[model samples]
Target: MNRFEDKIAIVTGAASGIGRATADRLRSEGGTVVGIDRDPVDDVDMAIQLDLLDLGAIAPTVAQIVDAYGRIDVLCNVAGIGHFARDEDETPEAWNRVIGVNLTGTYFMSQACLPHLLESQGNIVNTASTAGTNAQAWSSAYSASKGGVIALTQTMAITNGRSGIRVNCIAPGGVETPIGEQFTPPEDVDLTLMAGMLPYHRPAQPPELASAFAFLASDDASYCNGIVLRVDGGTMA
Candidate 1:
């Protein structure tokens, strides 16, 4: 239970939802969690106001954490956005925003944190979605970005596993989070196209997803690199 005792962690989107729960869980288990989000994060050990879309701010943010905590043992790239629309309704701006935050931001955060993680032989737990592995209509941008996250997770695991860094991702089905508000389907969208995306069970709570994140980041998953562990209640099975 105290797998993170004396460890330091960085969790993006820690202001709310799964990120907030993950931060709380890790800190409860004895990790010093540095919460990052554009919004205020008062719950974690340390809070940093950061917008992941501002890629240039990432390194400085990581530097600040290192200066304060000395080292980072885990990096949870949990921040992301989603936009839903029919193909014709999808605008370039929406597409870019989704991909930029979900994919590009995750990459840069990993880049900024890798050296510290390597020094600590730490790991990364990313938040990918079932939509990434399974096609979901009206979620083109979200799917593409999460798919990129899965690929990025695997590539990082392969590139760093021998060096003692493990990278894994969780493909969640549906979680009770405010992010759903951002992806309201277009009024004319076909209902049947998305009906299959529903979970067999009710959507998970934020704490449920946090448990999985905790497991992957803990030493107990020493051999779980490059794995996409689906937390979707058999939705994809």
Candidate 2:
């Protein structure tokens, strides 16, 4: 349980859901976690309120981490925004917002943390989504952004593999989280058909997916790199 003892981790989107779960798990396992998110959240060693879409804040934030922890052993790029816009209604702003936070934000965060990770020869885990591999109605922007994340993960793995830094991604299906709740169908939407379409007939819990992130970020997955581990509860199967 103390697998991460003495390790220092940085988790984005740590204000809630899977990010929160991962932060808590890491802390419980004896790691010092620095949580980053736009919204305010309690229960972390250090909580920084900053919008991931703002590239200007990334370097300073990473610098702050290095100043405090001296090194970052794990970086979890989990900050993201979802979209459910109709095809014609999708604006450039919407597309940019999703891609900015999900893809670009991941890139900046990784780039900022790479130096410290290189010093420690640590790992990076990105939170992709089933939408990256599978199609989702009304979520083209979100899907494309996540797909970019997967691609980035692979590129990082190949480029950093020899450097002793592992990079991997998690593609999660529908999970019970604040974001998931936002995507839930309205009262007019029929649940019967939706339930029938999914293999699990329900969404996954945040902790269930958090455990996967824990493994991917830990030494147990030392050989895992450039791979997208799906945590969809058979929904993608």
Candidate 3:
């Protein structure tokens, strides 16, 4: 179980929820985890206060991690934001922010970490959502961002797989997280349109998703590249 005995990992959105859980999981299994968040993070070997929206700061942040750790074995792009709004009520600013944080941030962070990952022959696990594959009401921006993440994950996998780096994504269903708590459907939302979006069981907890993240990042999945592993409870079924 010491799969990460000498590994170093960077987990984004690590202040709470799945990010925090993923950091804990990797650390528990013997990895040194550097946690990143716009808010303060805890229980990590390193805590980096960063807003993924500040794209300009990403490379410097990655550089700082490489300087301290000398290498990075894993990069978990888990930081994201979303809220439901009627299509007519959604603002361009809101859409841009979601795409900026979720999609653009993931891409640039991967780009920043690529050289080190190439040197270390490491891997990346991105957090996409089941919403990316399945349509839901009041989720145009969220869906677009996650869908982009799915595509980005695959492209990176293809682009880097031969270079000794693995890239994979997890498309999770409803997870009990801060972002989920704040997801209020538009007042006039149609319930029936979302009926199929519900999972077969209760929403997954953060640790469950974290476990999947760990699996994808571990050597155990050395062959699991360019894949979107759906941790949804058969919602897509």
Output the better candidate (2/3) by lDDT: 3
Query: Over the stretch 23-102, how does candidate 1's per-residue lDDT look in tens digits?
Result: 99999999999999989998788999998889899999999999998999999999988788888788999899999999
| Cα lDDT, all candidates | 0.92, 0.88, 0.92
Compared with the true structure, model 3 gives a TM-score of 0.98
Worst 10-residue stretch by lDDT in candidate 3?
A: 180-189
The parts of candidate 1 lying over 4 Å away from their true place are none
lDDT of 2 by residue, 161-236 (tens): 9999999999998887888644544345335645433546578888888889899999999999999999988887
Error of 3 at 208 (Å): 0.8
110 in model 3: Cα distance from truth in Å? 0.4
Q: Which parts of model 3 are misplaced by more than 4 Å?
A: none
**Model 1 TM-score relative to the real fold:** 0.98
Report how far off residue 32 is in candidate 1 (Å). Answer: 0.4
Per-prediction CA RMSD (Å): 0.8, 2.3, 0.9
Better of 1 and 2 by TM-score: 1
